[model samples]
Target: MSLAEKLCLTAAFVFFMTGLLTGIWKYRCMARSENAVAPRYVDIAHRSSLMYSFAALLLGWFAGYSAYPDWLNSVAAASALGFFALAIGTYIVHGVLRDTGNQFRKPHRLGRSTLPAWVIHAFMIVLIVAEVGGSLVLGSGALIAIW
Candidate 1:
């Protein structure tokens, strides 16, 4: 397998494991809650990790078929994978802290200090660009190779 494929598959496995662990955490939270509901962020973390695992698998499949060189494909895949990991990690943090249900709500404070709205918006912009741009690169390469 190409380096990009290996990297993506590895990430998929890690994400899947994280999802499982988070699922356990969710169960624990639910058991402790009077209403038997897990914290919103814990559920979000579990769901996101599971979804990202499949997304990583899709990326791996594309990377394997991509016409681009290994280095280029790896770089492109890494961009998206990195963001996916970052997002999952953030969710896990919020789950642990039982923080705001919405990270983008008014004030937007994941940390002690209220984050500026611009920073949150900027992060969303970069995340969209990285994930979409990187997927386009690999997907286009795969299409080119097949056609």
Candidate 2:
């Protein structure tokens, strides 16, 4: 496998392992809760980790099939994978802290200081662009390879 594929698949494996751990945590949290629901962020972390693991697998497949240079493919895959890690890490942090269930609510706060709404909006915008743009790059390369 190319470096890109290896990188993506490795990340996928890590995400899968994290998902398993988070799943156990979710179960424990649910057991402790009278309402039988885990902390919202814990559930989100578990689900997102699993989902992103599959996404990384897909990215690895595309990377393997891409016609682009291995370095370029690696960059593309890394871009998306980086964002996935960031999001998962954030979710895990919130899960551990049991922070606000909704991070986007009015007057957002990272910890003690209030976070500007635009900061979150900007991050969302950048994340969308990076994830979609990177996938498009790899997908286009794979399509080219097929054709």
TM-score, per-candidate, Cα-based: 0.96, 0.96
Mark the regions of model 2 whose C-alpha exceeds 4 Å error after superposition: none
Q: Across residues 3-94, which tens digit of lDDT does each residue of candidate 1 receive?
A: 99988999999999999999999999999999999988899999999999999999999998999999999999999999999899989888
Expressed as tens digits, the lDDT of each residue in 38-111 for candidate 2 is 99889999999999999999999999999999999998998999999999998998898876788898778566
Candidate 1: 10-residue stretch with minimal lDDT: 106-115
**RMSD (CA, angstroms), candidate 2:** 1.0
